[model samples]
Target: MPALIVPTTRLHTAWLEAHDEWGPGSHEDGFGLRPSDEVDSPAGFAAWVARLGRESGQATIEAHRVHCTYRWIVEGDQVLGGIALRHGFNDFVQAAGHVGYGIRPSARRRGLATWALGRILDEARKHGMDQVLIVCAADNIASAKTIERHGGVPEGIRDTHLGPARRYWIKIGRTAT
Candidate 1:
């Protein structure tokens, strides 16, 4: 079974390979793709991984930044995908949501996203949050369906710097599916 693990260098190569195959990942909420040059070297990549892990675990963040936890969806030794769970909502988080995830292109259409998201929702519940928002690109039918399956109540589309996005609010532990 695939489980969510904290970002670690052990999965860096596998994660990098997956990202290379998929090209730049979904730039949801300013977590843009890593630069190609940086990902080219092992040391650089390891530092990058360490930085992201540290950034998320910070007890205090700048006003513009928020605490988030980065997790990898791994099945045994392979890193299949990732997710970011924001600690709380700011103006940016309000539009983006508490949870954002991406499955490698090769892993798409195999029910992985739905499963991984379900796991993330369980984590969110543990945080004692009443609700969380999840947003997807407006035309992303697959993502919309995944969110709906997790009890995502449509909050309508909103304009973003990238483009229009579909947003939904999920009440914790509701088990709509």
Candidate 2:
């Protein structure tokens, strides 16, 4: 329950451990919900972290930017999950969201996803997002509950790159207490 969000570099070792634990292609079930690829490799992951640190500007499909990826850390050490806060309409409304996350399998059911998302929402508000969109697989009850617990209202369902996904939105101006 300590700070759930941290710099990806702060938990690089833990990120690698969680990736190993979840195995390849595990991160795909969340976010864009696609299999791990070259960008998911250890070195690629490090570069991604560096990009987040740069915060130079918004990213484009052809160009990348920093601050797009955020990691959820547990106990200020272990990485339980992460989300890529992509900018622009395509990312905001489709591929990614104001946030997306996944708890490591071994760490599931401990409310980490809930806590992680709550933290992410706060970040969204800080970024001036009035409402944040979060989408999860329709069958992912755990993720649905986590979203609901964080004040996400069922906005609708949509077919995404990963198949049927439930879309939820949370008003960032309000914090769950």
Candidate 3:
């Protein structure tokens, strides 16, 4: 099984491959580096890693108005996907929800996102969070179903600046199936 480990310098070497796998219009939401980030070379990617997460084995990153922790879903040496857990909910988070996640384009429809969220929910339990809010686009049935499979209850839809989105809440510490 893959594990949700904090983003680390050890995986910076995999950045280029992962970045290329995203393709056009893929979800770059939880990716620590932005489309504009300097990742031309290994050294540049390593430097980008410093500001995003898991520096020296811990997530000390502070961005997007929350104490955010960026984690990579990996199996052995391969970077499969990523998930973001925000410690605090801001106005933007209130509508977008607490958890944001994505699987690489090449690895989609393989049950990775659901599995990633399961592991992320375990991490959430450690933070003493009782429930986790997950948001997905109304048109994104795959994401919505993944959320539902994890016991996420629909909390209705909202028209946000990000467009129409569906919100859900999953109770933490719920036994994993």
Candidate 2 segments exceeding 4 Å error: 8-10, 28-45, 54-69, 174-177
| Predicted model with the maximum TM-score | 3
List, residue by residue over 99-151, the lDDT tens digit for candidate 3.
Answer: 88888778789899989888778878877778989999889899999999999
Best by lDDT: 3
Sorting all predicted structures by TM-score, with the top scorer first, yields 3, 1, 2
Q: Give lDDT for model 1.
A: 0.74
Q: What is the lDDT of residue 165 in candidate 3?
A: 91
Writing each residue's lDDT as its tens digit, candidate 1 over 1-177 gives 878777677776787777776665444222223444275577877766665664453222244486766777788888788777776889868877787888877877988889888877877777776789998999989999999999999999989886999999999854333
In lDDT terms, how accurate is model 2?
Answer: 0.62
The TM-score of candidate 2 is: 0.74
Distance from true location, Cα of 156 in model 2, Å: 2.1
Q: State model 3's lDDT.
A: 0.77
Stretches of candidate 1 above 4 Å error?
A: 24-37, 54-63, 173-177
For candidate 2, write residues 46-145 as lDDT tens digits.
5655544424422333332223544455665776665556543554455455566777788788877777677666666666667877888888998899
Clashing pairs in 2: 28-33, 28-34
By lDDT rank, best first, the candidates go 3, 1, 2
Full-model lDDT for every candidate? 0.74, 0.62, 0.77
Ten-residue region with minimum lDDT total, candidate 2: 57-66
